[model samples]
Target: MSDEKESVVGASLISEDRNGVRTLTLHRPQRKNAIDRALWVALRDALDAAGHDPAVRVLVITGAGGAFCSGADIAEPDPTHPVDKMRRLTDVALLLHELPIPTIAKVNGVAVGAGWNLALGCDLVVATPESRFSQIFARRGLSVDLGGSWLLPKLVGLQQAKRLALLTEMIDAEQARALNLVTWVVPESEVDEFVLELAARLVAGPPVALAQTKALLNEGADRTLRDALASEARAQAVNFATADAAEAFAAFAEKRDPEFTGRWSVSGRAVPL
Candidate 1:
């Protein structure tokens, strides 16, 4: 796709598309990109759009100005019922988690509370050295939301998850990387370019196969070994039915780079990834 940019929900969120990557930027820099109600709705809409867009091979979530998200905008008084308000967060979280394409969280600065879980929801997280993270819910007298309760323990064992949740201690990038919360910690100056290149690499991959691989891994944790193998076999069957798989073999034989179109072999149509 050609470069395109649009502001959503009173410019509280910015959506940009470059090549095959769609970036959703939290745009409330004045509030350190804290997700207010408008932003929550905007984000949900953006993720839903990207998930359905065939041109979007990768999705990147980041913040504007300096900091990443600081969690929900609790300071902004909302007369909306608490449960209804939380439903917005749940929508964004589930949409992000269930998105078919690969996702990356480009953490520029602080990512706390629901913000931190937002990054955790992505397939990969690339943070700067100066970035700080915390599960600040405990300190705010709120328990984890935005899938933190489920994601944290899976990323770092149950004990570590408890320690981070209960203590609400701020951790640096290196420390977060040590806990496997971050995939890479690039320098502040290089992080943007690094993520761009990474996203480009993902964009070049076979879209349907990549989507299936992501699904397998996401669901594998809860499945038995035999079930996992069965799923993998099913996935490979689907992959082989795609033109990209045949293109891969042809490219290998020809000693050339494979161009993955993710087209169905029989119908000559794009796979419904």
Candidate 2:
């Protein structure tokens, strides 16, 4: 594996800062951090590191200067070879969804085209008040790519997702919040701090329970009612076996703060308590 520091130096999409948060900053700030080949490779590596790194409790993806991302750089591709281009770009969003760690999209300004789906791929989204968004592929004579078609419907239901996808109009943060497009909308100055606070909280929480919750939620979404209930029971089975679960209840009984001892490792072994 490349040294983390060295990787950071070369990466354009994925960058790590002081906090435990792994930031995937869209590097094309001039073109609103539009996606490119190097950015995609760097992003995959960054996300892979964070997924396996125990230190990272949260992953934040945002734009550099203003806009979060403007999606793929159409100018880079030759119009004569349109084959497999959409699938390749869509893989980035898939990578986002497949990340093991909790992910958040900090939309500072606008997210267009695949950029919008990139935000959607994260587990949650928090946008600045000034942020605006649109699924603009249609406006460019292209249909939505990546997870937009599937994610939008799941996020805001069929009707609203249709309206947004079909019209390809801009939706401000306020409108996004009202439509359940984002978790929160704060001032631009507060976006970083707010996201940090959330990351810290996750870091401090019981790693076992937090990971279990995230896993269960992601998997539970696709299960049938009976299957989902079974999945929940299975999760609880694992959850109940954790030291954190025992510590949590014991602390409650003693009316003292729980000092959790659990590792986020996929390994079932508990941390030495």
Candidate 3:
């Protein structure tokens, strides 16, 4: 890697791209990638950059050295305190949920507490064999404060969410994948390679279509069937005008390799206004 690349690699939470798929990694493995105020700010900035940059097609979030994220730093009391940073964490978590660009979490290792919730916020997650998840707040004499309470129910049904949240049991990778909490499970050694391969495939796909597709699904999550249809219609209509759409169909007709111009608006809505 070049000097710039090396510096980026040294991040506490990193954002970098290969084949148009940008990855944001949590880099506090010595602390098991523990979450802190500074790290949260860095994460928000990275996501903001990735969302706004046209060259970025998909985003993958994982850990740097030993973990995905161990959750909030318990070394400090009050996971969110002094009000400001508390609010920021909440905001950033929601922003990731609504990201227009496809957001993925590669759970390469232990993901506990807010760490596990962060993984849930992503649209998809691919995990390594050694990956494990825990919602240990109850054990810490606390309530589920992150997006966990909300996102989990949407994912694994109310009963399962209650079991995971209240019991605070540690679940392994295979169990997580079985629950649809993860998209794939691979050997620890293959996690990086598999994630990159999927990212490349997404990058080669039509950018505008993908963004709108994600947006539609997000809106449909809460809307009634009729309302969802209306939402989809609106989103599809907007994509019809994008240059990427025309290029996709043209390339299909000619049966040739098509160059994609990843020109799509990364609306501030993706970052929670």
TM-score of each model, in listed order = 0.95, 0.87, 0.89
Candidate 2 residue 48 C-alpha distance from true site, Å: 1.9
- The digit string of per-residue lDDT tens for model 2 on 136-242 reads 98888888887888889888999999899899999899998898888898888888889888866766677666677777777777778898888777877666676
> What's the lDDT for all of these models?
0.92, 0.76, 0.79
List runs of model 3 lying over 4 Å from the truth: 1-6, 9-11, 77-82, 262-273
The numbered model that scores best in lDDT is 1
Q: Candidate 3's C-alpha lDDT?
A: 0.79
Query: Model 2 clash tally?
Result: 1
- lDDT score at residue 107, model 1, on the 0-100 scale: 98
List candidate 2 stretches off by more than 4 Å: 1-11, 17-19, 78-84, 264-273
lDDT of 1 by residue, 120-171 (tens): 9999999999899999998889999999999989999999999999999999
Q: What TM-score does prediction 3 earn? A: 0.89
- Scored against the true structure, residue 2 in model 2 reaches a CA lDDT of 23
Q: Runs in model 1 with CA error above 4 Å? A: 1-9, 267-273
Ranking by lDDT: 1, 3, 2
Task: Judge candidate 1 at residue 133 and give its lDDT.
Answer: 99
Residue pairs with colliding backbones in model 1 are: none
